[model samples]
Target: MQIRLAGGRIAAEVHGSGEPLLLFHSLLADRSSFDRITGQLAESFQVIVPDLPGFGASEAVTGGLEPIADRMAEAVRDLKGSHRPIVLGNGFGAFVALQMVIRHPGLVSRLVLADCGACFSEQGREAFRTMAAVSSAKGLSALSETAMRRLFAPDFQAAHPELMQERLAAFLRTDPAVFRAACEALAGLDLRPDLTKVDVPVLVLVGEQDEATPPAMSRELAAGLPDARLMILPGCAHVPQLQAPEHFLEATLTFLTNDDTGRDSERVQAVA
Candidate 1:
């Protein structure tokens, strides 16, 4: 389905019916990235996956990243109406999700951030800049196997050749200009200063072998949030949802269902 946002058209696919879960995919990926997990998640929650502007079926963002975030938040609000939705983001999509929480707090009830940074550290900014430059210069074809290798564990990529091919195709299809602009916006974003304001429950999931954002950075993101849980998926890389679907599904289901009970389990206790 398509919806008009602040400045562009949004193409989104929604599945199941229950509490709404808006999923945002990382750079170069669209709603399709969540195809495998969506059926599982949709069984419990209404999953709304949108092809972010300039990346998927959505229209280009004429204003830039911040506007893109705002537009996304608005689209969610407009699409779901009064329903309070759980927001989940992957990689660069996680960054936008955080931005949504920061700029449109009322729109997001809880956050599920996987394989992404919180944008509070210099290293994170620098890393984003590097990705943008590389993508712009050589398009997705130029992405070194070294980068792909880091994004997924050797075992997972080897086992899922078709999945890897689909991901690579998405990367190559991304427009260089849009990719560069998004990266520049990410480079300037810093959400750390406002972390305390985010009092909602947060679940942070990181792949053990994820070099793009790293586990330590995810730890920092969890640390800054009010009530947050961090889960490390074993033998996985940046895209755990794709790399470690079983673990990802288990952790995400538990979090969404509020079934976690132990120290690391789901806890609804508010920070404030």
Candidate 2:
């Protein structure tokens, strides 16, 4: 489905038949990033997965995170009506989700952020800038290796060569200009101070072996948010949903259902 927003048309995949749950993809991925978990999530909630503008089938529009969030928030408001949906964002999408909360309070019922932090370290920011430069000058192919390293853990890549190839193919299809723009935008992001404004129940999930955002980044994000908890998936990398889908789903379901009494669960566990 394509929804026309103020900025441009947003390409989305809608499934299931309950309350809305928006799934936002990472920088290197499209809506398909959540394909593994969508069925399970859709069983209990309506899953709305959209390609952020400039990726997938969405119209490519150049702007920073604020504009992107505004457009996405408008589209969500139109689709879900008065129903406040739970939002789940991964990597770059997580950054946009935080912006949505900050820019439009009460727009979301709950928040789930995966593999993203409040702000990147100086070194990380520099890395993003380098990615942008490389993509702009030589295209996505030039940065494929770097992207893979940031996206998946070494062990997972070594074990799942076919999966890695699949993702690489998808990465090659991304618009280099748009990819560079996103990287530049991310390099300037710092959402630490605004995290306090998020009042909804928030769940922060990160892979223990995640290299791009790291576990420390998630710890900072959880600590900064007013009502938030952090869960670390063992033996996983930047994309835990892909690296450890079962564990990811269990922790997510538990958090969304509010079955656990404790506000924080540092580790992912199977839900009985």
Candidate 3:
């Protein structure tokens, strides 16, 4: 259903009870990306997953990533109310969540930053530029395969053909304008200096085989934060939660519930 935010209405799914857990999906993917795990998550917390600013039923907004982040932050304020929620962001959504935390420090209690970094390498920025240009000129259908490759590893895609088809459908549903704007914003984004503002604990999780935001990027993000832990899911790619739901849950469940005391143990696996 549509949830009203300070800026606009957004499509969202809410489940279970306990503390709130907000999920932000990747640019190429929609909220449905979390379907495989939301049920189990709902068993422990009130999991709220939205289509982001422009990906699904939510209306699109202009003026770059700041507005996108602002809108999402508004969603946080509206849903969270008196409770400081736990936020989990994947890929582009991670960037949005980071900006949200930077702009509003006390809005959330903790963050599960997955497959995102403070800034991209030049080569990474160039990749987004090339994608935006191609998708703009030739359209998303032309970039479908490339987009899927960025989401899942090639072997994984080959192994899960039906799931790949479903994901492709989700990607094609994205608005061209929003896609280009997001790509451009991500290419120019730099959130390093603001990382210090996030006083809440963070779990910087990444897929070992992820090329989109590489493990190195997660390392940089973990190093920049005030209080954080880094965890790497073995043999997974960008959307590990979809590809390896077990590992994703194992790595994040404790942190999401705020029961993570084993900072040095491999309770949810280690980063090295």
- Model 2, position 22, has a per-residue lDDT of 91
Q: What's the true lDDT of residue 44 in model 1? A: 87
- Provide TM-scores for the models: 0.87, 0.93, 0.94
Off by over 4 Å in 2: 1-8, 259-272
Worst 10 residues of 2 by lDDT: 263-272
Which model scores highest in TM-score? Answer: 3
Off by over 4 Å in 3: 258-268
**lDDT per residue as tens, model 1, 1-272:** 43454344777877888888888998756667788799989888888888888766677776666778887887777755566888899988898888778777777778899887666367767876887777777665776564567567777788888888887776767777887887788778767787777757888888888877788878878877877888888777788777667778888877777854223433322211
Per-residue lDDT of model 3, residues 1-272, tens digit only: 33555455677878887788989999989999999899999999888998888877788889998888888888888874567988999999999999999988899988999999999999999999999999989999999988989999999999999999999999999999999999999999999989889878889899988999998898888888887888888888899889989888987886766665334422235533
Hey, what RMSD does candidate 2 come out at?
Answer: 2.3
**Model 3 deviation from native, Cα RMSD in Å:** 2.3
Scored by lDDT, the top model is: 3
- Judge candidate 2 against the unseen true structure and give its global Cα lDDT, from 0 to 1: 0.84
Please report how far candidate 2 places residue 68 from its true position, in Å. Answer: 0.8
Q: Mark the regions of model 1 whose C-alpha exceeds 4 Å error after superposition.
A: 1-8, 62-64, 80-82, 120-124, 144-147, 259-272
Assess candidate 3 and give its lDDT. 0.87
